[model samples]
Target chain A: MAVSEESQQKRRDERVREIGFVHQVLRRPEFGAAAGCVLVLLFFALFAGDSGLFSARGTVNFLEVSAQLGILAVAVCLLMIGGEFDLSLGSMIAFAGVIIAIPSTVLGWPIWTCVLLAFAAAVIVGYVNGWLVVKTGLPSFIVTLATLFVLRGITLGLTRLITGRTQIPGIKELTEGDWLAPLFAGQFGGSVLVWLADQGLIDKRPDGLPTVQGIPVSILWWLGLTAVATWILLQTRFGNWIFTVGGDANAARNVGVPVAKVKIRLFIMSACAATLFAAIQVLSVGSADTSRGLQKEFEAIIAVVIGGTLLTGGYGSAIGAMFGALIFGVVQMGIFFTGIDTDWFKAFMGAMLLAAVLFNNYVRKKASEAR
Target chain B: MAPLIELRDVSKHFGTVIALNGVSFAVRAGEVHCLLGDNGAGKSTLIKILSGVHAPTTGEIRLQDRPVQFASPRDALDHGIATVYQDLATVPLMSVARNFFAGREPVVGWGPFKRMDWPLIERVTREEMAHMGIDVRDPGQPVGTLSGGERQCLAIARAVYFGAKVLILDEPTSALGVHQAAVVLRLIVQARARGLGVIFITHNVHHAFPVADTITLLNRGRSLGTFAKDEIRRERVVEMMAGGRDLVDLEAELAALRRNGATLQ
Candidate 1:
């Protein structure tokens, strides 16, 4: 009995030590990006010191721009974590935008019908990308790079053949009639803040004054997508299969995982996401040029890598990618407010990319070594 | 009383290279049948056939005295055959519970709206691990953090949980330390107690002598012989693996060389 009691005490002591160890590891000085984000925010606040930049109106505009990029970044992050890349995403957006616009503007189809057709096309393109990659056993970089060029060329050729110009017009007619236009781009009370206020679902406050509590409809879309991605990544048997396949295909196959199927599904998901973002852009702007959405794939990839996703495969978070997009949005608008040259924006982006990669490498190394 | 699994004159060839030549073996319920072989002894080929990785060039595999053909590992699993490979087929970054429940996770809700039952998975995983005497603090912890022996044990427990009647362990102890090896051997005995037919493959004869009821030695794509542990001693088994009386000739040649060297020195 005495021996058992002593052993019990020892177990208790070990548990306490383990808790302490976990706490220390969790609280270590490795949150460099988080610190960097705070530092950037401080830099903007202290140096800019402009009332216009700090106003609620500025914040709303910032969120509006970030939402679109955030959606794209999250999708790219999922694909990157699954151990693949899609350089054709930007071209896909342009393709989808033109498809939706042409049908609604030129063919005079209902706005909803055009949107659905565009979504279906996105899904099909994504499926084809996945199928080709799996069937040929080629690297996704090569497959998607080839696809990017093919899609861009097709978009250009189709636009010139139909509209006899580089850019297609008459999209304004569709937006003027459709109710979805205001939801995407029209502002309430002619200000970004009032537009945000009109999006609220509930209005309740202690004071009689009107409470500004509405969330942007785009944010609702992001929230919905985030929930779905989280469910697919964490809560399904297929999710397990995806992680295993990405971690090591041979090992996953030996254990009876359907590796090809998972990759295909991920590809389809990415294309569909890009298409959805394109549809939003079309509805908001009410028009699109042949070169619309150029280089968005690089921006999406940068956001994903910055969010701490591994380029090789098997480790990442979709939510992190959303925050990475927000960082991009803040830097872009923040630079503009500081009266910095727009051309220097690319240099700042390059520096941010380098720093994020270095930070991710260090974090990943530390995580592997821990415990 | 019927054998849980049996291979009848199985012959497999990889292109022109013959891997297994008309080898037959039986594993009875609650028995440890050790398959011993040197390098390139066609042990891996036999394992591949049993685990449904490859079909035999000529032969019939019988489970419960009925002929069976497995199209995939999932098919083999359906027939209660589970193989724990040397690398312990699992995702290192995923949680222990996730690895255990891969390809067959429990779900709640209807189609297209279904979600994994995480709480149930955690509860069942903990219960299963406890039943196997594996003390783990969190089922959420990644399997990569576990020791090699613990990983093997987790695989064994997973097979048993999935209702495997035949557990084929391929070189499970080759990469383990002495203490870790002992732990695995104890788990083998535990599996036997649970009425599993275990095909424990190893190159070491000493490790087999403790838990194996029958030992089969293979050399050069052919079985040397199968021996009941009670009938043949460890030395005899070692001798057969060393190729009958040829070991004695080699030992005498070494002794003669030593004697000549002593005189020269």
Candidate 2:
């Protein structure tokens, strides 16, 4: 007992004093993602400063883009951690958008009713995707791939059938004074930004508007949801279940974890995230098109992967995905600021994703297996 | 006292193949009952039924003399029965503490604002591992870094910590070296001392003879018989395991073959 007590004391001391900054950072699965975020920011800031990429206005511009993708990326990160995928997520955004827009604009439904209806449709699609994957024992990739095409095809066909044009219009007029509209797409900090510009603290746009006019509410949504996701992943029993199911489904089942339920919930969450993104898009743009969320599923998955989430599942963080979306937003918008030909964008993105995945694998090996 | 877990005349069939037939096994508290068998000798089938992986086709299982039906593995676990399979049932990439308190992790605070009790988890994991005679310096370390024997120890300790009345270990020592197998046997003795009814399953006679209080021999899906340590000698048990083909007869055959080969030379 005396020897054991001494060893226990030694362990306690080590726990308290041995967490070096380098070790602490290396221990985190998202450390590489955090470093990559910094590298991307530095690259854009250095190469594109002349176009005001480092300015407050420029920051908010990229933040808006990141927020939209960040919402989807965060949900994708959770699903990936739960050992599943939803390739239908991107099409879900378009489907939800069209579902909301067609009813609110053409069928004369209230915006609130339309939003709820769209969410309900998303829930059903999400449930079906999860149920089919679980019951059929098929890979979620193939299952959601079918959903992707089916949802997209239906969105395109239905939009054309109803409105003659692929795009639905007159949303701004229908939602002119709706209370829920501003919460979803409203801008804030406008007066404060205008005051700063008037005092010459920031630049004015060529249209005579202040550069940092206001911050998009979606940024708030992004930060808020990221916090919630982090909490769910780290603090809850459900979070532990996610890690277990992803790590090994059979072992999880043996230990009494409801593997099917956790996976189904994750799928539902991914679809709901797609719908949330659609809501923001439709409300902000005042219109919806069949191709509104084109390629968004792949983009969200790329962002999640770049954020240090394992494609095989069981290890990742929502914060990493948040940082990944920021990197994507900065680079995509920073190219415009740099006056570079946008044709090289896809190649550049592909290279960045490859580098991030390689770096994450290296970090995972070091943290998991190495002494 | 009644056995902690008892299976009476249990038989399981998958279509036409009878995996286990009329096998009755009992493990009393504070006793180590070793189940011995060769490969495909219905050992896997028996343990699966005991751990609720599969229901017995025709039999009754009793817990402390009361009949019990386990609908799922969770139901078995809830009734104080736990199983540690050959694979150790661990997530390699997860931390020791996380793997320890995985499915039923303790949480603090209220709904939508709750968090894992990390302090409690780390403390309990380290303490429990130490109690099991393994000093885990850091519970935060990934379980994959531990040796195979250490992983088995961790799994056994986890079962004990979860209030298991009966611990069923399937081939826990099959993959270990000499020293590691000793470590697992030591853990089994420790568990028995702690009053847990341990079902130690292995094919090695040497492994079973030392730590087992009761021995159950299985062959071709039927139990040869269950024997107490005093009732059976090591040589006799080995003969029983070899299907009554005594080693003396085998050696005589080998000698006759050698003489013929020598004459031919």
Candidate 3:
């Protein structure tokens, strides 16, 4: 009887405490980002409802912009989660664009070959940045900061030397009718927008063109890359290595995790993502300029920080970063749709960054308190 | 049979400071070798040398009677020597299963498509923790949430499960309470029972006396001697650890003060 009673008591003590659904959601690492995203959307919906902010056209516009920032933000998220930063991302974008344009125009190389060359160059730059950071044991912030200037200088000097100007033009004419154009810069669902315009379901420009034309291919790239990154972070060995190396580099080294190799690979991946963004931007605008990607590196990092990643590293997710970029996209475009002055945009972004970081810190504290 | 690991006359020096001087130690299979010392006895330096964090400045290290040199910690791990440093064994933010298989994760798929074997990692982590007498509620929980003793147990269980021939634990029980320290000591005994050559570094004689088969004493960067449990009594061990003369004099002074029945300001 004593033994039976003890067993029953043990079972009772060992029973898992049932958690409520609200608590469950709050416990997720991305909960702050998701909540912030919803709040931002609701704010725009209520304030800018009459400015066609909810229209398909406005939605696509925000999404297109979000897609661009999202691409860079997602990669930055991966790097941040792995316990590093790449401040050279924005400059790398300009550098990659220049690489694509100058080669195709000045050298008369085929468009696709230029794409390959740009990608290779981006990866090499990223690798060198990572190698210097890990080998010298310097903080990535300082290393990438130095790289940022170096790259910007190179892009400016090279562009001026080659074209006798800051921007490279006539790329669209040179790469006209190229097969790879559609893959990078083509639009989708244009017929749907046109039909809606004919049916009086959406606004039409003075020239009879629908405000909603089609989805940019960059949106597709954003979605696809987010999915791939989420998979790599959550389901693969390299993903685990990323978390390990970022979480505690010394412990990871002791366990033989090859810390330098992981950091280097992440750097290369970040650079490749930058190249993709540059390629899309170059093809869409049909030009590459020295100042094309100015301040984009800060925007990408801001998006990641808003996504609930720790500034100190070791904890984050890609889906969270996606939602963070979504929040950013909505706010950036939503401000324009409102009657607010465009000059207030930077101030609003700074506020959002501060609020998101405070919210993330609060959520982390609440979740850890349960233990 | 040959000892599992042998450190012959190993000395480690840091510039002008000699941290470990002419120290030799060994651990046999199925035994717990407790390395005992005071604050500056160079126990850490000795363990670092053994774990390959630092190379011995002068002596040869023999694993099963063959001379070997470890260039890094990874080399030591490759030789089946796993070290679990105090408070540094696991990453606090990572999940239990992830911590269990941090460096050597199991993969199920082919190249590029190759992925972590999640089910296997979770199941094995759960089983190994249970085997170490810990009932982890969920393998997905972060290691930081575990109790300090539970974390140490997890580290010991991990080393055992990973086929380590020599388990080097650095001050595993130093920060633990009485109950937790008992739990860790029990795990050490369990490891010894499973035929692991355990090197348990601790300054507590009472904790060591319960489970150690051989005790290696160190003082001021030098080894006093290595003695089997039956070869020396507990009092002698404690006195020797406190440098004998000083400890005896201190004890006598305390006794005299107590006999006077006076409290001093």
Candidate 4:
């Protein structure tokens, strides 16, 4: 009995240690935005009183805003961890949006066909970005910057030539289609009871109006992508190679890793992700503004950096990037409740970015010192 | 037995500069062949050629008495030739197990469904490290956290586990302290005991004189001579590496400096 009790106590101690270690890692100084996100949530709950601020409807609206940004942030996190930058992502999103819309609305192609073509086009652009960067041995920043300008120019010229305007109408017919519409735009319920009510399987609601209890379908997509990215980053050999290449290309090559191939793949993935998100937005909003995705690259980069991913490369997390996006959402909604001037939001964003960067550097320095 | 690896009349040039000229060396199994040289003595150039980082402009490389041309490092690796550079060939952020099994990671399943078999990798990495007498607390810890001597030992162990018949160590002990250097020297002997042909490269005679079965001196991109362990003394090897004629000249120059100082006084 004594021996068994001692063993049980030891096992409990080990479990506690493991949990503590995980918590310490998560709260690491580099993950400033993660902590900031929690603080922001509490701040809103306390300050943004019940009615127009802290209500369930307001929370849903906040989540809806963050869902799209969260997807891009996760993609950018992967690229950053791989030790490269993509300045073309924002423009790529616009490019993809236009690709999907133009074919469906103007060319009269089926919505599914347009979606497939848009995905393919994004992958090709990514391939080109990767190939050019690898073959030329140029910095990815320069290569992606060049691509950004070229794609932007192409987007502008194509949209103007095809539609005679900078904006294009979303495929209304496809949005109304029975088979294709629900996947792109759907909602989730927070509970089983609410879910049943939302689905109209249970006629519990008095007014018969949909309760819309679950989360947005976009949030689910974002969560699923984050889970996949995390698994790839942590579990796969390719993920290991990604960290190695980003940390030091020459060193990675010396060890016989295909550095060039990894870099190229990373570029392609960033472009493909941007394009996919753009397609989702088009189906949801029913319109594509040529300028819609203009500043999204900066937003994505900010979220990635704020998430504790190194700008220089080799270390970061997708989950952290998601948290970064959540913080952005809360701030955007919270500012309105605080009666702050909407124009001041950009300045606030700039301040938050600077703070997050400083915090990340400090944490990295500490971790290295610990080593 | 025939030498496991041999380079005959190997020569390499880069535009206007000749990095190696008529460089020749051989390593038999179960022996430590030391390559001694000062800076700019074509040591690096020769290693690069043997390791398939570059092809010699004019020369023949033989493995088990058969000529072979390697297009890339992977080709060299395929032939059981591993080079452990002075930096130790490790990724700092990766776990020790990951770095140990880098390019040759074990996989499960088939096709796109294949994934790294972590349990196998971890168990094997732990066993290998333990056999090497490395007391690592966790195989999951980043290799960067280990000491310099430990890292060098891990590199040697990794090469041996990967079935390297010929291990080329480029200045393995140059960056280590006296105690750490001694640890690496012991590992070299352990490798030789395991029937590996280790080509230990270094500028320090003391480090090489103890374990080396043969010593070859390189001076100014040319081979001074190759001597069997019984035929060469440590001082002579050092003298040859310092450039015999150049050393005499340097001594004379120092004497002149002393005389001139005396006259001024």
Fnat for each predicted structure, in order: 0.41, 0.59, 0.58, 0.31
lDDT (10s digit) by residue, model 4, range A197-274: 666654444675434456678888888888888877777778778878876677677778898888878888888889
As for DockQ, the candidate ahead, 1 or 4, is 1
Q: What digit string (tens of lDDT, one per residue) describes model 1 on residues A171-285?
A: 7667776766555544443243344444542232455322433435565566567667767877777777776777767767766778888888888888888887877778767
Residue A294 of model 3, lDDT score: 86
What DockQ was computed for model 4?
0.42
Ten residues in sequence with the least summed lDDT for candidate 1 chain A: A201-210
User: What is the DockQ score, from 0 to 1, of model 3?
Assistant: 0.57
Stretches of candidate 1 off by over 4 Å are A1-36, A49-51, A179-216, A366-370, B111-113, B233-265
Docking quality category of candidate 4 according to DockQ thresholds:
acceptable
Clashes of 3: 0
- DockQ-superior candidate, 2 or 3: 3
lDDT minimum window of 10 residues, candidate 4 chain B? B135-144
Cα-based TM-score, every candidate? 0.87, 0.93, 0.92, 0.91
Could you list the CA RMSD of all candidates, in the order they appear? 4.9, 3.2, 3.0, 4.9
> Candidate 1 i-RMS (Å)?
2.4
Give candidate 3's fnat, 2 decimals. 0.58
lDDT of 2: 0.89
Per-residue accuracy of model 4 over B13-60 as CA lDDT, tens digit each: 999899999989899999999999999999999889989989999999
